[model samples]
Target: MAVPHLVQAVAETRGLGTDAARYWLELLALTAPDDRLIRELNGWTGKDIDAAATELQQRGLVIEARRRGATRTRFLPGGWMEVSGPDRPMDVWKAPHHLLWEDDRVHGMIPGCPQVVPPAELYLDVWERIRGGDEPGYTELRTTPHRRKRR
Candidate 1:
């Protein structure tokens, strides 16, 4: 299944949530780092944050926002920052592996995937339907009602 619009975009930043998606886009579009303080987006991290950042920088979707610590300066992909500030958004798309890294589930299963596959060996889907809080009636995929008992 196709990844949801937000999910695909979120993978550009961090997790598969709208906030995560917007964070990276905001950082890319922001002229100054201070702009992020309001939402406290300046301080955020996760196990995958570094990996995501590295991938984005390599793809040119992001640049070093700073020069200290893990923060370096970011610039458009393939553009020499020494000569010009940055390149247009279009240029980054031409770079190698320009697209964001999407997990197989997102690329293969559902958009903005939540990784709820559990164990593939067991009947996980059946359990999901039973646990989704929706009362499961004795019915088939069409959800046909069970036979009624005579009064």
Candidate 2:
């Protein structure tokens, strides 16, 4: 279970329900994979930020890395992924369009958002990348253990 920075933050600062926190974690992972997660820090005050982050690490929802004089961290979603649908690595579906539709699952606000990774690509891409997040986004894996495309 990897701990995304935002998930760790919400859990610590807002006491975000685990389910909601998980939802948002997946959301951000797909929507803003490269974006730094300090928004979680910004949403807090005083030492609550550090407190929440520490608790998140304790819960195994996040991990921290230290190098030189700098430190970094992020979230992990394997627990949720293991129990999710289709019994495979699922991709993040992005749709920032009121034209698309929103629910507990997928939605978005970026129309003609070709600038985005084409959310449709995530689910198609995840099965390969989920095992080892060694690549940039979830779609860069070409050596999937279960190499079967959906029909």
Candidate 3:
């Protein structure tokens, strides 16, 4: 099957309900981030959060966001920051990965980790940590040995 068709098939098999799909699509269209999106996905699908994220990554739909300037790597997704535009003064938390369906496929390697969670989930987790007065850091991408060998 073609890439597009394969993506669609995977989406269908995963069955992101109308509501969840709408929410995800809206966020992607707006280029905005929502803390509740991943939580809602978990509730809707009853799949482990990490598992859902892994599935998405395996499909080449999303990539882990790299932090701008951090020495030590941490797995906090909320720490991933991007400047929206030159005019924007404050950094906004955005989804780490772009919507792959729009571009057909992602270029370059997709980062993998032992405990991968969707950006929204990671963002929320980091947010909570910060609220609790914890420092947010970078997360090192650890690809499997086979993947590393491919590089």
Clashes of each: 6, 13, 3
Q: Please report the TM-score between candidate 2 and the true structure.
A: 0.28
| Model 1, residue 139: C-alpha shift (Å) | 61
lDDT of 1 at 110: 27
lDDT string, candidate 1, 1-151, tens digits: 1124533544543443443344444333322223223135434544334554566556445554433221234433333211111211222211222222332111312222123333221123322332464321223457668998999
lDDT (tens digit, per residue) of candidate 3 on 30-58:
22223344445445342444454454445
Q: After superposition, how far is residue 40 of candidate 1 from its true place, in Å?
A: 2.0
lDDT of 2 by residue, 16-112 (tens): 6543454334433443322243435334343544564555556555444422212233334221121122122212232231122333332333331
Q: After superposition, how far is residue 44 of candidate 3 from its true place, in Å?
A: 6.7
**Which candidate do you rate higher for lDDT, 1 or 2?**
2
Tell me the alpha-carbon RMSD of every candidate.
21.7, 14.2, 16.5
Extract clashing residue pairs from model 1: 3-111, 4-111, 63-74, 64-72, 64-73, 64-74
For residue 56, give model 2's deviation from the true position in Å.
Answer: 1.6
Predict model 1's lDDT versus the native.
0.34
Candidate 1's displacement at residue 6, Å, is 4.1
What is the TM-score of candidate 3? Answer: 0.28
